[model samples]
Target: MPIIELRTEIKASKEIVFDLSRSIDLHKISTEHTNETAIAGKTSGLIGIDESVTWRAKHFGIYQLLTSKITEFERPNLFVDEMVKGAFKGFRHEHHFEDLNGGTLMTDYFDYESPFGILGKLADKLFLLKYMTDLLAERNRIVKDFAETDKWKKIVA
Candidate 1:
């Protein structure tokens, strides 16, 4: 398994940042470059504990569909989503938010294992890890940008 952790500081309340992070609409916007779309289950609103979403996106020049469920959720603090079905062997992504001085510190912990055994490990080491990391970073950048500005209202309201 490979784990990727990222931290971002955004000038916004933890509540706001937390809500924005779970917004299905915001995710679609953030991943627009990948043509990501929510195709089923809680496709448009804030996703809560036990809720699931099916996403379709273009990655590695191929279209893939991934479905994940929110296994744990604590408002304005933490949430965990695990893959129900996807390309990878398995994956779990945890989102954490902490209040700071006039802002919030958002952290992402993504753990995943690829299929194909040894060959998958090689792919992870060679390029998959970096690719996934970059995707997460880009998503966080979009979240930070929205949370720090008034643009969040468009998606969350």
Candidate 2:
């Protein structure tokens, strides 16, 4: 299992950051690697604790459909989603937020493992790990950019 953790501070409210983190629409806009949309579950507004959503998308040229259930959610603080079904053997993501100096500190924790045995380990060592980590980092960067830039200013205002 490989885990990636990313943290960044944003000059925004905790509520704003938390909402942006769970926004499927913001997610789609942030990452070109995914074409994701919420279907048959929580609608595209904001997802709270215990809310689940299914996403259909293509990753690495492979079409994948995954359902994740929210297991832990604390408003403007923390949220966790665990994979129900997907390409990966296991997947869990946690989002955390803390208020600081009139801003918010946001963190993302990703833990996942591939279905393949040794092959997965080999791939992870080669580039899979770096690729996936970079992808998530980029997505977070986009989120930060969107949240800190005029994009969010207009929306939040």
In candidate 1, which residue pairs clash? none
Error of 2 at 133 (Å): 1.5
**How far does residue 97 in candidate 2 sit from its true spot (Å)?**
0.8
Candidate 2 residue-wise lDDT at 113: 93
Q: How do the residues 57-151 of candidate 1 rate in per-residue lDDT, one tens digit apiece?
A: 99999999999999999998999999999999999999999988889999999999999999999999999999999999999999999988899
How many angstroms is residue 42 displaced in model 1 relative to the true structure, after the best TM-score fit?
1.1
The superposed Cα distance between candidate 1 and the true structure at residue 87, in angstroms, equals 0.3
Model 2: residues with Cα > 4 Å off, grouped in runs = 153-157
TM per prediction: 0.98, 0.88
> Which prediction has the highest lDDT against the true structure?
1
- Please report, in order, the local distance difference test score of every candidate based on alpha carbons: 0.95, 0.80
Give the distance in Å from residue 2's predicted Cα in candidate 2 to where it truly belongs.
Answer: 0.7
